[model samples]
Target: MFAVTVDQVGSRSDDDRVEQAIDVVSTTAAGRLVLPPERTAGDEFQFLLDDAGTLLDVVFALARSDGWSIGIGVGDVEEPVPDSTRAARGDAFVTARAAVDRAKDVPEHLALEVAPGRRLGTADVEPLVTQTVRARQRRSREGWELADLLRAGHSRTEAAELLGVTPQAVAKRWSAADLRSDDAVHAALARLLTEADTPAGADTPA
Candidate 1:
């Protein structure tokens, strides 16, 4: 299981965006969430999920916007799960809280934690995930525009037409944005996250 906690950064100075953020994440996380995201405290929200790929999607969606500190905790949740995230209990939630607090001070504003005595490989995986997210955060607006179009299933020619640019230009943007590298990173991160979540000596699905 994964528990994600997000806290609004600069909340005192910025306009309240909790609702908007929730909307974005909820959309990205639809059908995969164990508990629908909900505000847990002032300017903070939490959600539960089981799939690492969905967790990655949720993290990327949140990272697209500024002013958020994201933390993911991987571990077991107490059985007899509650319908509300706030009511959920276990090491996952505890570690998520700690992870979020640490995230506020991190360069990428993201962090990962594993319940003590579980998923010891998380130590190796977290840094790579953080670095990839940091690189993604540096992507330019033009890069994002092209990326969005391509991600929507538009071919380079189609995206170019939509953006009123040449296909060459679209290709240039894609290369400059390192979007190809993102694909590899995404696959690696998902696999790594799954491994990190798997307890030592436990059988992991191929």
Candidate 2:
């Protein structure tokens, strides 16, 4: 299981954005979550999930806003899952708590913790994920607008039409945003996470 815990970056001074974040996670991870996202405390929310791809999607969606510290725990969850994330208990949840606290001190405001005794392969997953988030943070609003359209399966010409810009403009924004690199990072990160989560000696499909 994967446990994701998110804490607002500046909760004391900023308007509460927890509700909006919960909505985003819930929507993006619909049908993939082990439990519905729930507020764990003021300006904090958490959810459990099993798929690495969905985990990336949820993390990317939240990281785009740059308002939350994200911690992902990859490990085992105790049997007989609870109905609510707040009620769940396991190594995944424990690591997620520690990971979130660490995220507060990290430059990228993101962290990942694997449970004790789990051996991950050679890939440096956290740094790759952090770089992707940082790239998204650096993206301009226009870049993101084009990215969103492309992500939703729109062709470059169609995205240009929607944005009232020429296809060349959309292509330029796409290259400037380095979205191709982001897509590659996404695929690599997902594979790394899945590998990390697999039990020792388990066979992984090619």
Candidate 3:
């Protein structure tokens, strides 16, 4: 069996909600589970999965069922058989542990990438640092500032100029705001334009 963990997303502080969701996901499926948060931080969970793939499917199912978001990570096992080498156990557990910690702030539905040597790196894991930073910025206070500039038809370079900063600075800020993806930038611009078209204080949601 391999170790795995799932962490949920909350808009505010939803420690209880995260715990409840973890329990539901763990017990609903057959796995050796541990409540790390209950024992300590109240923000994470741990489990030993007989089949990692089975747990991953259940993780997604639980996220949908709870209407909450979750990030998942799995560690490598030296052997599929029980009681594998400590090195393998430590390797998988440590990497997965690190990924899980990072995922707490990442957007829902994005799985953590396993590092090289432990498990072959997945496409999902590349540039995760950039992705997570961008994800957080997209929902952050600065996200609003960047959105305003983009809606004014500013090219990224132009936006940087308008913001009185370098192009690299603009890209950094924009990427940090989670506008790195063209789809994300376009969507944010569309929302901003739509909002601007509305009268001020019209009681319409932004």
Candidate 4:
């Protein structure tokens, strides 16, 4: 089975609103669908399809006139092993993730075919890191960083006020940082804070 992930990008911060939008899109689309997306990122949906060509065509056709940008990824299992069903699901997830990245780079109304080689991780992380730094720099230049505002214990809306950006933007940043998921984000942040407090070069990647 091939995994087909369709991700729609829109401007919204409310998790409920985003989920509703995605639900509309998924219900209106085709194939055996699985849409267990992290909340607020609802514009994203993943599906397992036997035919890639048909799935891609239908998704593109359905999305073309919706005033929304949609990206798709087509992925197959990396290896043949036990739990074939689970493996296919993983492939579908990776494909959808690649599609999201492609959509971010291009303008709306453009349909991109996500070849495996062009998917994420194939590209160097330094450029992404640089872009993130530039965005952070711009935010810091405009006002206090989101980190500082959060560290100061300001409410989400209050942090937005301090940063001179919309409350949605603040929420997006927080969610994008994976803080919405209690266990994953807490563990990640704890490890990051620990590493930061440690001396540089004390722990190196293998």
Q: Candidate 2 local accuracy as lDDT?
A: 0.87
Candidate 1 lDDT over 1-206, as tens digits, reads: 88999999999998889999999888998888999899999999999998888999889989888789999988889989998999999988988888999999988899998876654555777898898888889899999999898789988889899999998888899998998887778888888888777777788747
Model 2, position 27, has a per-residue lDDT of: 88
TM-score of each: 0.96, 0.93, 0.42, 0.36
Candidate 3 lDDT over residue span 18-73, tens digit each: 65665666566645433222212344555545443344345544644443433344
Give me the candidate number with maximum lDDT: 1
Candidate 4, 1-206: lDDT as tens digits: 33444444454642334455445545545434443223323455444443433343344334433434444443344454233323344443565555556656654432333234322232332233223323333443224356556646777889888778898888777765533443343344333322322333355322
Q: After superposition, how far is residue 153 of candidate 4 from its true place, in Å?
A: 60
After superposition, candidate 1 runs with Cα above 4 Å error: none
The TM-score measured for candidate 1 stands at: 0.96
Q: Rate the local accuracy (lDDT) of all candidates.
A: 0.88, 0.87, 0.48, 0.44
Once superposed on the true structure, which residue ranges of model 4 sit more than 4 Å away at CA? 13-43, 65-67, 78-89, 109-206
- How many residue-pair clashes does candidate 1 contain? 0
Which candidate number would show the highest TM-score if scored against the true structure?
1
For model 3, the superposed segments whose C-alpha errors exceed 4 Å read 31-40, 66-71, 77-89, 124-206
* Tens-place lDDT digits, model 2, residues 56-89: 9999998876789999988899989989789899
